[model samples]
Target: MRRLSFAIATLLAATAMAPLAIARGPDGPAAPSAPVDKIVDEGTNRSEVMRVAQYLTDVIGARLTNSPGMRQAEDWTQAKFREWGLTNVHKEGFEFGRGWSAKNAGVKMIAPRPLTLIAAPLAWTPGTNGPITGQVVLAPMADEAALDQYKGKLKGKIVLLTEPTDITDATDPDFRRYGDADLDKADTFQLQNGGASANRRPSSASRMAFTAKRDAFLKAEGAIAYATMSSRNGKLVHGQNSQFQVGATPPLPGFEIAAEDYRRLTRLAKMGAAPSLELNSEVSYDDSDTKAYNILADIPGTDAKAGYVMAGAHMDSWAMGDGAADNAAGVSMVMEAARIIKASGIKTKRAIRFALWSGEEQGLLGSMAYVENHVASRPVDPALTGTNRYMNWSKAFPIKPGADHSKLAAYFNLDNGSGKIRGIYTQGNTAVVPIFREWLAPFNSMGATKVATGRTGSTDHVFFDAVGIPAFQFIQDPLDYGSNVHHTDVDTFDHLKPDDMRQGAIILATFLVNAANAPEPLPRLPLASEPKASDGFYAAPGAH
Candidate 1:
């Protein structure tokens, strides 16, 4: 299993970053007080976070964006919010090209050896032509010349292009939680520059050149399909696609087999047995129904004139798994926090809003759309952006009237995993250090004691943080999130711990209440040093 990178990158002004992201402060810098004991005790005693998590992951299954499951999950969320007394429950839509979902799929070894196989097709790829039979080929397609060598040779062939999974020894405990030392290590990380090569796409440049070569070769050779091995063990499938652009060419049918089964085919072909296989798949893009969704619910405040505090988690997930730890856990956590506070009868000066976002897996699409619609905007900042950057950065629009940018006091987000919350990421606004330290004080006994000054990325909070509002993501135990759960078929209800879920609910609810009743809004970063517009959700092919 690959190790998780705990280090955060240096803050950039384009995304509303404040220098290094953290420091230590001994006392409150005027943080308002809350009835933490009452909220914490009530939240800890009777919580349904896990129950809701189970319902979403086990019952509703994967909520892939714009899919039937996602649509149903949206309706379910609104129903639950209304059931929980959250008023003004509704859905907001955004325009995107299309949605993709996986249906029935199958693969098997039929000749030279007859056996059923554990495998799945990559999402958004073309499906097989009804279990077409083909001879297997171990075509590396190593370079442009190699791809040419396979010309006409791959006709009616099943091309194997990937290696078996890395079944390494457990150097570290996969099931264990984080220790104090781990938190200390993450807390003290230096904010490093996002170098020219810092965040380039995996296997970029050469990857694109070779991919274009291979795609052309496959199309010319009339290959049956492309098959690779799953990256994780036990037939857990993992895949992602970026060809959602309008008029993108139809991708060739692509499939992934279990690591062990993959090596079996490789061994047979290498030994000259020339095994043959069968594949059948069904998939389609929802181009006609391509509007994305973001679920919203408001707990109306008594002081109608006061600002509001917001919290949310993305509800979308990879279609292969139940999306238990990667996000359903987060979705339920936010829902339960709202329920806990409402049930605890914790009233505040500011309103609290709960959001369940979609299109997060497809490059923060839903959250960025939300920011464009509500909390964030691109006001004229002469110090940051020049004339050219303004026209090109389509996402950098100024906050519009009645968008409620001013009323938004703070936004808290959770999307790490099922681990217990250990602390908060200051996101480089050190003034909040003292305030968060105060908010987290109530949960010290529950093992959520630290408040780190690191910048965590690739989530919804960045959408809010991009506009200079106070936003944060909590630090949690890693567990097997990186190795086994994330984007894997094993991301199911079993990975979530009820105790951990309850603890997270208690801590975040208290934080929400404290923020809602705070004497002043959380301090904001004086816009970033020089805003240059975002590079994008993911680094471009030429970024390296």
Candidate 2:
């Protein structure tokens, strides 16, 4: 009976120490770098990203950089950060030109037949005052050479920059959910010593100059407006307007007319008939403003001395329709991730910076500026402008890493689409492969289990990766973004799947929190050895 009593006392002692053992996760990173249960449960259960998205896309309207709507979005996001108890909430400024917004420009055919063509104004293009009539003229001035023939002849005329769209038969499905094979292909990665196959991506200054000269000559000729057909078919009217730079004069009105209408106009011009149309696309330009900003907020870490983890998405988007799918989804992702972390009161070793960048649609202008101001500064590579120059180019300027460059643990981006978190792109940082694999472990059921080295482009992450920082863009399902929705009027809230966005927000929150609590900082690729993201795409798999 005395031995049994002793045993009971020992059992009680063991039970008394159990809470300490339970505090540490089994076989997990030291401490709760990113407490999976806390992140996932709170992330998915209380998702605020989509609500932010609805306000940005549905309520505030399209957030074209420098536009009033974009300003409104900035105010709203900052207020949200303040309300969420995030500290260091403010804006950072950079030299920028003017902002532009559009009401609606009425463009329709009035001659050779009364046909109304659906039209959308490009961003910076000024509106044609009142109803201006001009006969359609086929002016394929691709360069200055083509402009010689039309000198003084294009006065008061609508010019078609190129021919009508060549409608190809739709072969593949519009929407796609990537399968295992596709993910496997994307997972493979290796850095080539030289370069890979060329894809005609050179942006030569001479070529640009020639094109610029042509535009100058066209403007000098007093053209009423410019019109072009969509590069892809099915009434997809792709357009851009912000050609006016800081000191440059205002842009001429332009229209991305329906492909069918462009074809009709060209056909009539080919025949003896004359085709005419009315154009009015006025834009609100912010001539007085010389600078723009990115919204910045932070959740102070318990260990402030350990540096920080950063996450951001561009707030600026194409003026066409609402910029929902192209980026409103992404902006919401990071913002929502920040919200989740702050709301859950997740403790971390590192602070988290949530950034909402502007002027992303304008060639990563906002992010690049931010990098120059805060992260690193390098001379502009004229060759880098060319699609062909994306490879085989060395740093043109010495990099002056910013004070915060070393302290920046990593930057994560989300800009693909409203698809669920399928995978991640390591940008050839194999060291991160295993790390991401671990981060994605709990998300396997959500189908975010893959972490590949493939590279996807044309987003703000390029700015981060360009500076030798370990920046990444998630590998999201296509969801017709490339084929149809991106940069089109159809890219609206309708295309977003809430469940997918919610899943993405939750996943992002976990990643951010984990990065903040990581025992070691992420490894960086030497600036010299790191190749362009384009090269990462074209290089043969496993061809180091």
Candidate 3:
């Protein structure tokens, strides 16, 4: 009887210390370093990455910013975060233009041969009122200067928008995983001397101006329709256009034809056949909501004063295939990363926010809006309005930081197709190199090792980095994303590598947790100033 009473007392004492055991010294419920093994097991042994990818790509289909598919994606992703018990799960909206969708599209040759061709309608362009039949005209125009040459002769014609270039043989393998040598080469530091600045193409402003002018000219000339040759060598069609703004809706219908088929039409035209074609582009516009949304959810931190760390992937894609490799893969990984972190039951000192950005295909509009609204602000040039404001906003001076500018501890992005996480691009933030090295060490055996100091632009991270925030993109394997997929009709769910996606999610979760618990926020780059011309060259219009 005496021993039994002592055992009951001991049990009561142990039960009283349970709360103390979980407390980790003013940091949070979890240890200072994230539990990497737990993350890996959750990400791998029971992965939901593929399921998420399938739903986003196969079920949701192409997500062109404010399109119906994109709206569905936003709702579905928010539902997922709430299901996972993530806090602050809501969408932030910004002023976007119109949404577009292709109901049905087809192009067929009627005269030379009754052969149907692979084609897709360009986004934000009008559809043919109905089926329009016209003779094909090879009126290749590169700029507005060339538009005058075909001014009055294009009536009742389907104009070939670009000249056919000689198809080149593939030099590198279409599908490739990085070898040790490739990773080593990528590790070399790049100089910021801006060597390629001397050979600049026309600014985006000029290019857009030409696009507006050319579209007006074609419509004024009574052209029935227009088609552009695919830039890719394979018989893939990517329906890409940038006329989504409210006042910038293109007047005439446009389509992108497979390269081989385009070349055949060009050859027939050169041979004096004048291959007659029939086009039917049934599309619609949705102006019900001119605002595109960014999906945001958070795992609340123990210390609100400690800033938040973030992970993001663009949820919007071009209107082509399912947008799997180009972005849905990345989106799945980010979502899975958040799931893994929440499921691991680890509490961080600072919050961890997951963002699924929209309008990324339309010049990183969603992320740029986030930076401008929450993190920092720079005065936009009054002269550079419209799309030019987003394109060249980095050129503006004196960045004005917002209330939460310093509260963003660090941001990591993943958008380079469905390749495995090889490593990370440091984006020239030398101070964070060693910190990333420590966080990435746990996954070294999983093939994520290198930390490159190169700058990769054109993704959602550009605007954040431009504002001196510690933002970065991962280095992924160069799987056919550049060769055949990316913006092509073949960027479907079949191309995503499941193993790579799982590894990427595990790595992303580890980084976010580690950054959240770190004693200090990641170092920031020096605030940007007006850059001097590298070669005394001025590419902007009217610059002397």
Candidate 4:
């Protein structure tokens, strides 16, 4: 994760001015208020949330952007909102290019001994029509020179593009619990030996050079396909790292075989026993450029004149596993919260908007487009009379200036995983920290404590805050999300904690209700000049 800890510290320091004082009557702590009682007793229906989650994950399967599954999810969501009686319930259509779909995939080592190979296709890559058998070739084209060494010899063959790992020891703990510290140690271990002349490996430079060489090799020789081993154990974890630029030539179809399986073939080849593989996969591609869509729904307030409060979660997932915990959990939380509010018949003073966005796997494109089109001021005429007129007209042309600005009381988001809400990130919005404290008081019994004023990034909240909207993402405990579940085959319903999901729903519902009925809209901090970019923390290469 990136370090917004500095921003968090600043928010806490500023918010400390006014300690949140819980409301009290003349007697003492007053009895539970009507709103609080409503939330405590009837809010966060656990069974309903679990039911919806199962339907989306088990029945609908993976909802990759623009896939049939995503379209099905949209229809289900629209129907769900209508069933919940949400006002203005509909899928706001947007132009999206050809959708991609995966049917069946299989890989096997045929020669030297028959054995199944665990593998899966990368997103948007073309697939083999049927079983295609070919001799295996160890062609580590690490650089241009190495690539030239095997220039004319890779045709009609499965190219093994990575070094075969030494499988001498099978019980190394580093292989079992491969965390960040272990990864750093691995790099240092390599550096200790004078394997390479450079003291430190040039990872970025090496990757760029290797990519170019790989692409050239693939095109020069009509290779059958490209295959690499997943660094993890023997599991077909699907993912992609290529930057498929518009004009650049696409590489041969790519797939990741398990490390153990690849090692077996490599060992057999070293022993002079010719190894071969039969690979087959089905993938559909839409070449036309298409823009992804973001689903938005609103619950109009009883007082139609009030401001808006928003909540969101990225609906798209890496075409890997089922995308259960990485995001489906967060999406379910937001949906369930909206359902509870609408079901409880809470006619809030301010409207609440829920957005389940697509193309989040690309680069926050969906949210960025929404903000730019709806919030940012735009020139009316593309052919303007003068620069001054364009600038002058733009200043007064925000469609709904008040509503688009901080008129949003607050925007809450969930994306960490299916964990209980530990607390809320103030996102440097200091003025509203005390108010959140009061709002969170009712849920203390649910283990929702530790409120901090911090700014976290790599999520959709950044899109809102960039344009001066009061936005925040919650802090939840890391529960096997990073290593085991995230973008892995293990991210399924079994990993979800039912208790955690229910707790998060209750907390989020309460927070939104309080924000909706607050005496005034959440206060906004003065905008700061854009900060310079820095080589910060590690983020998933293609995460939205």
Candidate 5:
């Protein structure tokens, strides 16, 4: 394994740019830093990172929470950790709802003219057994009043829940660029109605209601299945446009049909031609609730009693695509970083933990559980009284606190995309900005200059930060992720950039090494005394 050469050059260049008091060669005063050999070495290679990423994305495919693929991913990751000589390699499991997986799916139109349709089953959706044809109906339950109109009417029909979007060539240049203003404006643009009521976009609440009603109608009126048109043109894009069925019963077989086919069906239905079709699928769940597992591995520090530093990335992904860009890249990057550190054989003062979290797509559930159960100094059942048997056991033996980290150092996270890490987000922890600048200095030649003071949401790091842990998430170039690969069928192994991943791994590994060896831990902000729950975090408009 060959470490990144660019990283070394970048660090030297950054050192030249900054004015520092250092000793002259052999006989001068001691330099301000430790030897470079102790920071990084030539063992971290790009080939290995790419190989691991390929295995995860191309071999395992989509890893939706507790799906079979997710289990495979967990096993594979644990094996890799052990191979890397990491300690404390194990799976920390927690109970979650049983999730559904699709083996195969297909859609087609046999009416007026034959045409095959591109379709995918929504997560946790029930599948139709074999093929059954039915008339397609334009059922836009727009509002409560509109829903009332269809109280007992949709029976044995395919309901099209989405509205049609007016096709136009209006593209915003500002939106094409990456910046805060562009993001803000892009969000605002999504909320604007394009002059139609029945074509109004649906919200999360509306989608939930629609799912419930569709399922109820299917059960009562004997409907064969349900279908919705993909809103983003006729492209076979990927994303979970369905509701999260935690402990609820599975709904009727449902899928998102191609936009073109849906348009044809809607037009025919409007002309009283009653568009009908058949649907069939196979969906089942394991007997146990879906178990969310966090892959925990650590590189032991030379000082057995030193505090710990950590780096992480979510291992779970949306059910639609292979999840290459949305998170597989991040997972691979962090894992590669750890491998690099271990291969370099650098001894540090603080232990470094690498966590690959599951259930990130389902509201950061995995990280939240870990923090609540293992990070906080609280018991699971706080209601038990002192006289209770569960409590008396503590008197027999002192009840120790959870993973105490008043000595905890810092946590680094990467999840933006497959792009090279551009900089670090302090997440309002301004006191640590100068330290990150020093850490990032070594990567300036790799195009990682910007150091913004903004805060970011929608990733696993939020869990640690909420509980007073000094955590940070890196910033990266967009790299067509949002528009092309993110949560889309195009999110495959090919979308990943090996050079980018290599650069990220080296930078991350070097930073962790430096942080671990630093004389003092990175500065911390006032403890996050008020931790916000993940519920409703992404509920606001334009929230990811």
Candidate 6:
């Protein structure tokens, strides 16, 4: 999953609760169908979910989109889908940027008491040809305005990117499951008084522009390399870099150092010790294909006119860890669901499609491209290029539905972690609450209970929900994902729980079958329209 702010994490929408008690199906309170029992048996007794995760994470390694690893993952997933008797298995290509991976990276202090530091190269950034030795400088460059202050002062220096701050103790446990109180809190509806775009920070466009300009300045000033402090207190490093487009690649080698090591370097530099450091970043770029592909396969339905239901997960991850808890878990569950359905010989009226999206870490690029190509689209401003287009797309007007707009019954996403299914965020689609409750009843004993009216963002489901499709992300146990493993060096296969994976697969398979054969398509939230200005002090008379 992409990183999210507190606002996006707790984002909520209004709900019309009139339909909460009544199921939409013509038959009252639909129970788990006979197919669900078969799905559970297959997913529980004959599950291969752990093996799938092992192959994807342990074998494939980190799948940076369009890189060699990602290409291998796309091909392997399609092969697996075909091997399981899924029909129409293929890869759908989308315009993405250059792919990059770190071959090797190291940083160590050479002067003022030698010490080795934990670090990794920032993704999509250039690599030093070999080891580069230079004196460290605490430049603390934040934005373009600070560039003028360091003019002609950074020559042959390893610049520390941000000011070091004292680390604080964590307030909450690193690993946790949803307790009854937590689920009850989630079930309560939190009313949103204003528009979603209320209090905002600088746009991503401005950030990207500043990053490109800053990199150019650094290179022109003869800086040898740059290092940034890790966000967490532990020796955790997340090699996150977003300048991945063809023309916008970063100009200088970048590394993320462990927080404690970075602070020590900062202290040394502050005391005028003039610490010297040796840096080496061995990396490569793959420009062989500018396009990334999303792996897709389908189970054909009996009726041609009936629409399709889908399950999806991103198959891309950061360069650091094996990408296990972040998304390989989700991918494994999605694959296991498909295998279970096929193996159980369950038939449905509507087709079921399983999708493995790529370029998700960068910004829901693959899924958004798929939505634009086959689901729905709105006119985007030509000036909004790269990530900006996706960041600001929900504000676009006059959404135009594609031929498959209505044909898509629903899309369910799984990307939180290797956590078990706790519940689901309904995104305030009131009409589906009762139906979902019915669908979730079978898993009550497995701890999948709550059906919240709140919403969450920063995943592949955002675009589908924005375009008025019935899309949702399940609420999963955190289980050290947010605290210790998410995008960190420890996000490996060891953190995955086999029982959680099996539970998720069973629930996913059951939900897909229910939606596929439902009497009617699942309800959709209204299509987006331009929202009223949140802070209306300078508003136009009729701007809405």
Which prediction has the highest TM-score against the true structure?
6
Model 1 lDDT per residue over 420-510, tens place: 8999998878788877886776456667888887788788887577667789998988888987889888899999876677677767787
List, residue by residue over 29-55, the lDDT tens digit for candidate 3. 434467766776677667899999999
Candidate 2, residue 344: how far the Cα is off, in Å = 0.7
Distance from true location, Cα of 117 in model 2, Å: 0.7
Which runs of model 2 end up more than 4 angstroms from their true locations? 1-29, 192-201, 204-208, 381-394, 529-544
The C-alpha local distance difference test score for the whole of candidate 6 amounts to 0.85
- Flag regions of model 1 displaced more than 4 Å: 1-32, 141-146, 163-167, 192-213, 245-251, 377-403, 529-544
Q: For candidate 2, lDDT tens digit of each residue in 1-544?
A: 1122232233334434433111122356354446555555555556687788899889987877778888898889999999989999998876666777776677878887787786787667677767788998998866666777887788888888885656678898889999999899987776544333222345544554565576677789988778877666677765665464655554467788877778878989989698888787665677777567799999988886899988888987777768888889998888888888888888888899998888777667678777877888776554343222323223434667897788888889999889988989998888788778877766676778789987766777876786788899888988888888898878788888777777788788878877887777787888643335464346678876
- The deviation in Å at residue 455 for candidate 1 is 1.4
Over 4 Å off, model 6: 1-34, 190-201, 534-544
Rate residue 217 of model 2 by lDDT: 74
Question: TM-scores, in order shown?
Answer: 0.83, 0.87, 0.91, 0.76, 0.81, 0.92
Give the whole-model CA lDDT for all candidates, comma-separated: 0.75, 0.75, 0.85, 0.66, 0.69, 0.85
Candidate 4 per-residue lDDT, tens place, 38-84, comes to 44334432236666777778888787777778778878887887788
Off by over 4 Å in 5: 1-47, 168-210, 239-247, 377-402, 529-544
**Model 5 poorest 10 in a row by lDDT:** 386-395
RMSD (CA, Å), each prediction: 9.2, 8.8, 8.2, 11.3, 9.1, 6.8
Candidate 6 per-residue lDDT over residues 1-544, each given as its tens digit? 2232222122111111112222346556553353555676677667889889999898998998888889899989999999999999999998888988888889999999788999889999998999999998998878777889999999999999889999997899988998988877777665433445622534888888788888889899999899999999889999888878886668789999999999999999999999999999889988878998999999988888998999999999999899999899999999999999999998888999999999888879889989999999889886665578777777677799999999999999999998989899998788889888977876776788889888888999999988899999999998999998989888999999888888888889988988888878898878777666664457679876
The number of residue pairs in model 6 that clash at the backbone is 0
lDDT, model 2, position 209: 59
